[model samples]
Target: MLSPKKIRHRKTFKGRMKGVANRGATLEFGDYGIKVLTCGWITSRQIEAARVAMTRHVKRGGKVWIRIFPDKPITKKAQETRMGKGKGSVEYWVAVVRPGRILFELGGADDELSMGALSRAVAKLPLPCRIVKREEL
Candidate 1:
């Protein structure tokens, strides 16, 4: 379980995700994962790194949770197109970054690129967010 402060940080850091799903895929909680607690914005390149790492360990499976503020605003044409005008209400996102695959459990953003919170959240996780092979698990 995450501490409340960490949970809050996670919400603040999840600003860059798309939206949320009740229970989507079998890969809900990644086999290997990182839970982040943040407040500021992150970059695409950083997210890409985590994604790349996750991909390398695809067999093991991994997920990155980024938490952010709920009422913060997002200003991107792409976001408007994907999430509409009244979105961005949630507080975090779950991004699974794999080399050949990047799965995003968006909280309240538009496109995956805008998910800075996801990137930051991934950075905060204690362990490296690399997906290991089934053999390791």
Candidate 2:
């Protein structure tokens, strides 16, 4: 699983999601990428699963770039626990995803191979996503 080696705080507030992602929306590092169509939380486990699927499909031939990181800590209360104790303990980390954010990118692969690898990764994700080609310059 991908996680930060060190974090400033153990627990943090849940931030607000308002607009489309201003940053990380463009494919900066690959020829083909996965663009999210909706906003949601992407757990580290989900990211890892998608990466595994993509790598396996490509047989490690192409280079992959993960554009997002799960730095936000999500706290959770125990099951059936009484309320009013305080904020729950940190349960897991999630990458807060906004619409139009690019999640994964692939380079060094042909169109057919790239699409096939990306499709495999898309199935592991929770949101609807599309494989996008890099803009010609």
Candidate 3:
């Protein structure tokens, strides 16, 4: 049996999650894939530019996933330590994506190339980003 405190804590967490879930609307979804335009902390102008670049490839018929990390206040010490200028502060993770590779794995009509496609798409993005890990799903 769960303690009273634990039950209360779980309810509170669920309530918070429910509130956040209600704020956003699902922009797009499909049987084959989905491209969601979510809220992020960076400037909308910057985010839109990246979206436009990715959209071009999607229009050509490929699965693409996009997510924008919300902006947060940065400390001066940390700001100076980063690789880029003050702008490259850790708080600014503009966008992250996991472009699908079903086509490549199946050897479809187009050349199925996951790494190449992901790299090319990421190259056009504004912020510094990389593919950290890969996992089977």
Whose lDDT is greatest here? Answer: 2
Clashing pairs in 3: 41-70, 41-71, 104-112
lDDT score, candidate 3, position 99: 29
Q: What clash count does candidate 3 reach?
A: 3
Candidate 1 lDDT over residue span 46-98, tens digit each: 44555554444332333344222223222334443665564345432333322
lDDT by residue for model 3 over 25-133, one digit each (tens)? 2323222212222322233344445445545544555555443332223223363375655333222222222222111111111333434444445454443444322
Q: What tens-digit string does per-residue lDDT give for candidate 2 at 1-137?
A: 98888999999988887789899999998899999999999999999999999898888689999999999999999999999899899888899999999999999988999999999999999999999999898
User: What ordering of candidates by TM-score runs from best to worst?
Assistant: 2, 3, 1
List TM-score per model, in order: 0.26, 0.93, 0.31
Output the worst ten-in-a-row residue range by lDDT, candidate 1: 66-75
Evaluate residue 23 in candidate 3 and report its C-alpha lDDT on the 0 to 100 scale. Answer: 20
Clashes of each: 22, 0, 3
Q: List the residue pairs that clash in candidate 2.
A: none
Candidate 1 has a TM-score of 0.26
